[model samples]
Target: MLMGSCKSLKKVNTVSIRTTKPRKISPEAQNLYKRLQETTKKGYAFGHQDATAYGIGWKNDGTLFKTDVHEITGQHPAVHGFDIGHLELEWEYNLDTVPFALIQDQIKKIHQKGGIVTVSWHASNPISGEDSWNRRGKPIKKLLPGRRLHRTYKTWLATIASFFNDIKDDQGRPIPIIFRPFHEMNKPWFWWGKGKCSADEYKMLWRETVDLLTHEFSVDQLLFAYSPDAFDNREAYLEYYPGDDVVDILGMDLYQHWTAKSFSKNLNDGLKVIAQLGKEKQKLYALTESGLEKVRISDWWTKVIDQQLAHSGITWALFWRNARKSHHFVSYPGHKSATDFMHLAQKDYVLFLDDIVPIEVSSEAQ
Candidate 1:
């Protein structure tokens, strides 16, 4: 009895270090990180912008003619894309402008269905309520610290933070989001684009925004993506990169700017450049946005996108929206290219709904 009592006292005094305890990364973020690591070992995922909320070829006519991925190919895309352009202006959820409440619901549904969501922002020039390309406003420097719009920018970031915070699954855990802000900055069109601000200024803006969203707001559910337009080489692409620490994903938006024959070559070269950079930096990379607007080529999916992505260690490639019949990316049922797209969807390397690894929904319902 004395020996047993002595052993119990010793057990109470000893403390375990638990060296194998996993870091407290959010479940969604951890799932995405593991999947990205596995995707390089597996294959790339396919995505589409504004896919479920709306589509070009057809709309829900109360029948079997919804042209979103499932309606056309019997499966939803592995990734769903959204944008927050009009939210800064505090507008209701419109076609491109996703209001907070609507987005929250959409995120829940998509997550429940075992899919991923990526978001982009086309923040209007804060000085002018015009489009994103409106250069009539002051330099991007004005939005950084110690400037007139700095306070306004903080309010915008708070709004975005609140929006993301509201995005909770059934268990109330924040959903993992790939937040790509100020995309296509390498192009001199948007207010934050090149020629509008110096590289140092742009980097400051990016870092400051990230610090605000991550540190200040304590939002750990987001994976920041730095995306630029297609550049000739790595030097040009990395010119505006914020830093390795701030960015979790490296992506580039490449559209078919040249003729059909040159489309594959241009996109392939850009992908090669991004792939090399991602490998060197040890970051996940994606074709954040691309599409032959109107998709004139019947085999564009296989010949252009698939051919270029072949053997590339890309995580995902998201095509632009199918807004209207005149300007659409994916083909509708009975469309000339729909058959070719079916082949693309069924390929061993390309992944769609059934092919994607399922994300574990929070078992703790909130």
Candidate 2:
């Protein structure tokens, strides 16, 4: 399917691809990075978190692949976001109760359909054995090399590595993923967040994790993304950055926590910071996670979200999931914002699944 579709689209130039850890990545991963960079030149892609595993009033029963976005727009998102929160504990199901096996299946399907996949890790707190939000202690240092919890952290990473390695196409090629771990680190809610660990400690944690997965575990089908919560300025956003060589994508997770006006301002400011940094570092960037919960405002999608993202240069903007009645992000069929969302989907600058043309890579490039 990908090969047949590619004949109609321009082929991705694989020469001198600019990805972090280039030597350690697979050919497919390198091509994906190049393809994403090419995509940003045209427009930013639309993404939805956990779109297929479950959605408003429905969950994947290991049978059909469905999403509220698809049900409304008649297409899936260009990018699919999934969380591996509980996979660190060897749990069959993630913290959101989506099965790991099911997540793998959905990832493969999305890739086969020429959509992108980005995975975030809400890893459990190693120090307290609690959820990812547990800030009981400074666990970053302990999770470093030769520390008390280092072995345990390695085991968790091994589990994650295995899961990533298992995401293969029907032809047995590994699917490239934008691996986003310890996201929103500018906030203090998670154990690895700002106040819980020093910036150096956080950088070490990131570098070590990348090293372990790329060199130690030989999991090469990944492009690491560094995302922080909304920040006041560029300096604040880069406080805990590992380095250019360890991060392929620079991202931010800002939502409509308050007024739409404030959300728009923050979105613009955050995108400016990343756009500058991405240009300087030659890396891709995205609004890794976002959206107003419930999408109460009818014109929020077009007036607010799309307006901010116009020529933003970010690769994609992923809305959060549609969990239940009061907790959804995107609109459903009968919701107030559904029509506006449809209009947003129709916009030329916004790339949905149907709008994207798969970039063709020659076997030699792979």
For residues 1-366, write the lDDT of model 2, one tens digit per residue: 011010111112321111224336688888888788778877999999999988878888889878899888897899999999989999999999999999999998888888999999999998888999989989987987777999998898898889999889888988999999999988989999988877777877787798789877889888888899999998999988877767789999998989999989999999999999888877888999998988989999889988899888899999999989799999998999999999988877788876665655554454
lDDT of each: 0.74, 0.85
Assess every candidate by TM-score.
0.87, 0.92
Error of 1 at 174 (Å): 0.5
> What is candidate 1's CA lDDT for residue 52?
70
lDDT of 2 at 255: 87
Scored by TM-score, the top model is 2
TM-score of 1: 0.87
Candidate 1 per-residue C-alpha lDDT over 1-366 given as tens digits, one digit per residue, 9 for 90 to 100: 000010111111222111111112365675666666666566888888877766754443223213366766788888888888867777776435435565667667777777788999988888776778897755577888778899989888888888888888888888988999999998989988888887767777786787677667667687778899878888999988866666778899988866966767767888888888777777888999988877888988787777778688898999988878788887777667888898888877787756775533343312
Candidate 2: which stretches are off by over 4 Å? 1-23
Off by over 4 Å in 1: 1-27, 57-67, 94-100, 359-366
